[model samples]
Target: MPEHIDKLSISVVVPVYNGGKTIGRAIEHLLRQSLPPAEIIVVDDGSTDQTANILRSFGSRITALSKANGGPASARNEGVRVANGSLIAFTDSDCFPEEDWLKELVKGFHSLEIGGVGGTVRAASGGLIGEYVDLHGWMNPQCARDGSVLYLVTANACFRSDLLFQVNLFDERFRKAGGEDTELSVRLRSFGYEFVFVESAIVRHLHRRTIRDYLKNIANHGEGQFILETLWPQQRWKANRRKEIVRSAAGLGTMLRFYRSYRRQYDRKRAFVFSLLDHCQYMARIWGYLRGKRELSSSSLRNPLTRDPSAVVYPNENLGSSSVLVPKV
Candidate 1:
């Protein structure tokens, strides 16, 4: 540990929606961290289920907040607003962090230049879809060719609270649970702050079990990709219809390669199924990309002058009235 580590305080923020069944377990795991956080904040993003009741059951163990059905980005922004720690760690309600997760994440912030640190995600359950997701390292931090992290997945990531404030927190325009983290990372990188990846800081995530769920996740990612490209045109490459078609065509070869790789470990039947799902994933992503393009175009037409992709809005600036922290019962 660095000499300055003792001066840092950490807070764990969990943004959840309709996660009544798993939120308790996630909180439990957080509480058992080897390097316990100074505070644990869970933001309930207007869940229609028994999520509120479950949160209440946690009592004073966590600081629970309730708000309208804003996306994960908005919910996370709310959590960051009230966090009392210098380091804010984020994880999903469906994730279970290991005992040393926080310790390892904190260790990565040994210097002032590191704006954030992220860990790897492992699948909690073992099913066909789960295995596929784990095998492909689906939720791991996306890295550059030289091993620099491009973006940290929020499923297991920690960032400096001050840096987050400087970036104006998360972009609420992302009305879903994807791409907002990537955009934040890009903005953070712009400040010349590096991000470290701590392989030992592991979190077990409950992956999408069914094929329908998996395909939906892939499609949502496609939409997020479009949003990122629009928001940071200079940083992200814009894909045209020609590029999209070419990418889709090339996906066939990728699928075959994945199938061969899977066959080496699993049975032929399972490999075939995995390859088929990969094809479906490609189609779903393309559809989502096209849909996102149309939605963005419509949004631009509706508010041509007011729309500013570069602007970062903090939660207190606009969302203070709409979001409220529920007092501990």
Candidate 2:
């Protein structure tokens, strides 16, 4: 620990599933951070590809763990199991970060009230779909005053290890990357945890390029919103009963404004086209939300203990001895 800086040991946890193409790059970036982690832990969620092989080659440089096929939430929980650091920094396998990323993250801990810190998750260059995502600021970690955030995105966020334990980790029920972080954030907010946004601790996120993938992401976000709404009703953020006509009209107005401001980035023609596409995607998201609502209702009826009155499972019932530590060096 330096005299001027507080001693905050950070462990970087990256949960990867079939990210063989990008995991290597993510790890390489972590290794180069100015404020490197005490250990870089990569939790492989039963990837059937060369992801496991790629992790194996890293050897002692990182602690690689493999678990049965679970979503990003469960994999991240496993990473916390073996983490031996005061702070737990999380990022996705597809992110390539700037060198000072961790250094900037650590500065947030100067205030003891700060529970977590988030960096901007910028979109990497892709095709039209990616441009739409970036334009919309989808999945990007947002700006916040030092201590005035609900929670930060897990893709480029760091939390106090004790705070995570107090919250009992993420809900394993989320079988995708979608709603788990938001759910966790809701809990942290209720507990009065202060989340900060570090503009400099940035990572470039790889957005989906293909239309199919982009649409799938939009739908997943909708589904996750449904699950989150049900799980944390106290948040009291209700969905609009009206979707198509009202939302599309509002979207059109927003697009027109967006185009005028960002014409250099996306011309009028392209902006108009993307806005229509965005509306269609939003419509598709409504469908997904409805399906999720139906599924959640049925699941709740079958397992009465599935949901708490507060929505999330507090004290994490599944914090059993089942989690394994696969420190494959």
Q: Model 1 segments beyond 4 Å from truth? A: 235-257, 297-329
Clashing pairs in 1: none
lDDT score of model 1?
A: 0.82
lDDT tens digits, residues 154-183, model 1?
999999887787667887777787788998
lDDT of 2: 0.75
lDDT of 2 at 205: 85
Clashing pairs in 2: 231-311
Steric clashes per prediction: 0, 1
Lowest lDDT 10-mer window, candidate 1? 318-327
Per-residue CA lDDT of model 2 for 138-210, tens digit only, reads 5655545653676578889898776676667887777777877877876666666677777888888887767
